[model samples]
Target: MTESALLVCPHCNAVNRVPSARLDEGPKCGKCHQLLFDGQPVELTATSFQKHIDKSDIPVMVDFWAPWCGPCKMMAPQFAQAAAQLEPKVRLAKVNTDTEQTLGEKFGIRSIPTLVLFRQGREIARQPGAMNTAEIVRWALSKISR
Candidate 1:
């Protein structure tokens, strides 16, 4: 029997059940009719963040950032690149600390550009700083098996 994964839609916050064997084949949401993985980081808010983290069977990597932080801005493009390289295996997301102060506080995020990797709704490891695309991808990949 083929297994399936529960993936939260990045665009509409809809929960979807996708076959694990067909993840790379490009699945669409049954509700919004949107592609499940669009090769980009999902912008998460306080309301949607929990659902994505708790429901997704795949691992989730979140970049906690703010608009005024220089390092955060510098890492934006690199994070996006990392998303393109990591999806189907992991889900990349961005949470703006400025806008989502509660989430930042809940996660104990003290600095901008903090990368938090979550598995099964729990944070496994977190890194505080800016990293290039190569570094980001490498770091994220290294944590999956842990």
Candidate 2:
């Protein structure tokens, strides 16, 4: 049998099929040939946010932040660290509330540092506030398998 997994291209919004066994090794996008997991949060717009949530087979954690939010800025480094540790297992994404207002409203995000977890296109959990690297990692790990 053929094993297939979903991967959302970070450079372009292309959904590519990746083999399950090759996920940890490193997977490249079929269209752009970019590494699927680059240890950075995927910058998501309104359109891409919806697409990624629906198309990604793995669990997604989205950081809802705004440019002017001080806490959001302070949490960036921690978020990046968590993303690096969780690579190839879970997808880390960021939604700028300043740009993606529609997506922010769609998720009922009232707080600037809200982190929403999505799996199979549905919201599984959400945490509101700026968390440290360990807290963020624990929260994300609680929702996904290693």
TM-score of candidate 2 against the unseen true structure: 0.95
Q: Would you list the clashing residue pairs of candidate 1?
A: none
Query: Would you estimate the TM-scores of all the predictions?
Result: 0.97, 0.95
lDDT of 1 by residue, 99-126 (tens): 9999999999998899999998999989
Q: lDDT of candidate 2?
A: 0.90
Candidate with top TM-score is 1
Best by lDDT: 1
Q: Which residue pairs clash in candidate 2?
A: none
Tens-digit lDDT track of model 2 for 34-90: 899999999999778888899988889999999899999999999999999988778
